[model samples]
Target: MTTTLDKRPPGAHARPTPPSKGRGFNLLRYNLLGGVAGWLWLVVVLLPIYWIVITSFKVQADYYATNPLAPPTNPTLDNYRFVLENDFVRYFINSVIVTVGAVGPAVLVSFMAAYAIVRGSAASRFLRGVNGLFLMGLAIPLQAVIIPIYLIIIKIQMYDTLGAIILPSLAFAIPLSVLVLSNFVRDVPKELFESMRMDGATEWGTLWRLAFPLTRPALVTVTIYQGLTVWNGFILPLILTQSPEQRTLPLALWSFQGQYTINIPAVLASVVLTTLPILTLYILGRRQLLSGLTAGFSK
Candidate 1:
C-alpha cells in the first residue's frame, strides 16, 4: 500500500512565472513621494531669499501696487547705487575689519589651546574646573553682560573705535570655538603627532605644520560661523559706537530705515545689500563649512 510520486524528466519544459509587480510598484511609489517632499522642502527654504531679491528690484509704486509674489515689471539698480553711495560701502568695510580681526585671532588661539588639551598630558582637576567655568559662558545670556561690557569698553577708551566691537566679538567666539576644535583635534591620529615629534619637530611646528593643514575645513567652518555672528551683531555696535562713521552695516541699515521712514523699496534694498557679503561667503565656503561643523563624528 506504499504510494510513490513520479518526478518529471530533467529535460522537460518548465512553466513560466509572472514578473515581481509588487516590488516594482513599491520602488516607483517611493521615488514619486520623495520627489514631492524634496521639492516642497526646497521651496520652503528658498522662498524668503527669493522674496528679498525681488523686493530689492521693485520701485516703490510697484512694491505697493503689485502683488509681491509676481515678478517685477520694472527692476532697477538705483537702490544698490544709493546704498553704495551713501556710506553702506564704508559700513561694509568696517564690518569686514571687525569680523576678520575677531575670527582670525579667535580661531588661532582656539586651535593651539584645544590641540594642547586634546594631545597633551591629561588636564589636572584644577584645570578641569577652570575649563568647566568657561563653559558657563555659553549658558549666560549676552544681554545680561551687555551693561558691564559697555562700561568696560568706555573705561578702556575703546568706545566708538573698531576695537570695541572686535575685542568683545573675539571673546564671545572663543569658548565655543575651543569646544568645537578640541573635539576635532582629539580625533586626529596620535601617530601623526608622534611621527613628527620623532623627527625633531617642535610642538609649535607640529601644530602649525601638521595639525593645521588637516584641520583647515573645520577652521574655515568656524571662521564663517563666527564671522557671520560678528558681522550681524547690532547690540555691541549700538552701545559702543555713536558716530555714523564707526557703525557697522547692521547699525547702518538701522539708521537707513530711520532716515527713509517707511520707504519699503529702500528698506528692502538695504536688507539685500546688508545680507550680500555673508551670502557670498556662505556660497564660497559652504563645503568647508559643512565639513568643519560635522567633523570627527561617527558616520
Candidate 2:
C-alpha cells in the first residue's frame, strides 16, 4: 500500500474565520439622522412653550408691532400683571378648590372600589363584573354624555356652583382611578392577603393596613392625574357654571378671547399661570407617579 501521505500539519486544517463583529452604528452612513429627528421632535414640543412664555412677557403693542415669531421688543411682566388684574386670583382659587374637592373624594372612593373588586370572592358576580363596568367608562367619552351630566346637575340644583364641575369631574376621573388602582391592587400577593386574614385582620383592615400602604404609588398617580384634569377642565365649568365667580382658569381664559378680538399676550399669560401648578406637581411627584403608572400589568 504505497499510498501518498498527506503533508498537512495536524492542527493546520482549514478553520472557518470567526465572523467579524460589525462596526457599531455608523454615524457616517446614518448621517446624523437620529440627532435631526430628536431636534425636530424637541422643536415641535418646545417651540409652542417658548412662544407662550415669550408672548406672556410682551406688551400688546410689541405683540402686534413685531413679527409673531419675534422676541418681545422689550420684555416685561406687564402682560402677566394685566392677566392677574382681571380677577385671575379668584379664578385660580375656584380651580384649586374644585380640584381638591373632586380629586380627594374621587381617589378615595375609587381606591376602595378597586380594593373590593380585587379582593372580593370570584363567586360574587357583582364584584367580579364591576371592574368591567368601570373599564367601560374609558370607552365612553365625556363629551358624549355631557348633556345628561348637565341635566343631572340642574335637577340637583348644583349648577353654577363649583360642585357642578367637581361632581362631573369626579365621575369622569373615577373610572380611570379605578382602573389604575385595581390593576395595582390585583398585583398584591394573595399570600399577603391570606396572611393578614390568618392574623384575624378584617377586609377593611387588610385594605388600609396592607393594601393601602402597598398601593401608595398608585394613589399618588391617580391624585396627580385627576388633579390635572379637573384643574384644566373648561367645558363642565362653561356649561355648568354660569357666573364669573364660578369660572375655572380655563373658562377665565375666554374672558381674554372675546368675539371681536383676542389679547394674545394676556391669553398666553393666563395660560402660563394656569399651567404652573400642574408643572409644580409634576416636578414633585413625577417619580412616584411614573412608578405607580407602570407597576401593574402582569397577572
Q: How far is candidate 2 from the true structure (C-alpha RMSD, Å)?
A: 5.1
For model 2, state the Cα shift of residue 268 in Å. Answer: 1.1
Score residue 64 of candidate 2 by CA lDDT.
84
TM-score list, all predictions: 0.87, 0.86
List, residue by residue over 227-282, the lDDT tens digit for candidate 2: 98888888899889888889988888776667215578878888899899899999
Off by over 4 Å in 1: 1-27, 121-130, 297-299
Report the lDDT of model 2 for residue 60. Answer: 84
Model 2: CA > 4 A from native = 1-31, 259-262, 296-299
Q: Which TM-score value belongs to model 2?
A: 0.86
Q: All models: lDDT?
A: 0.85, 0.86
Q: What is the lDDT of candidate 1?
A: 0.85
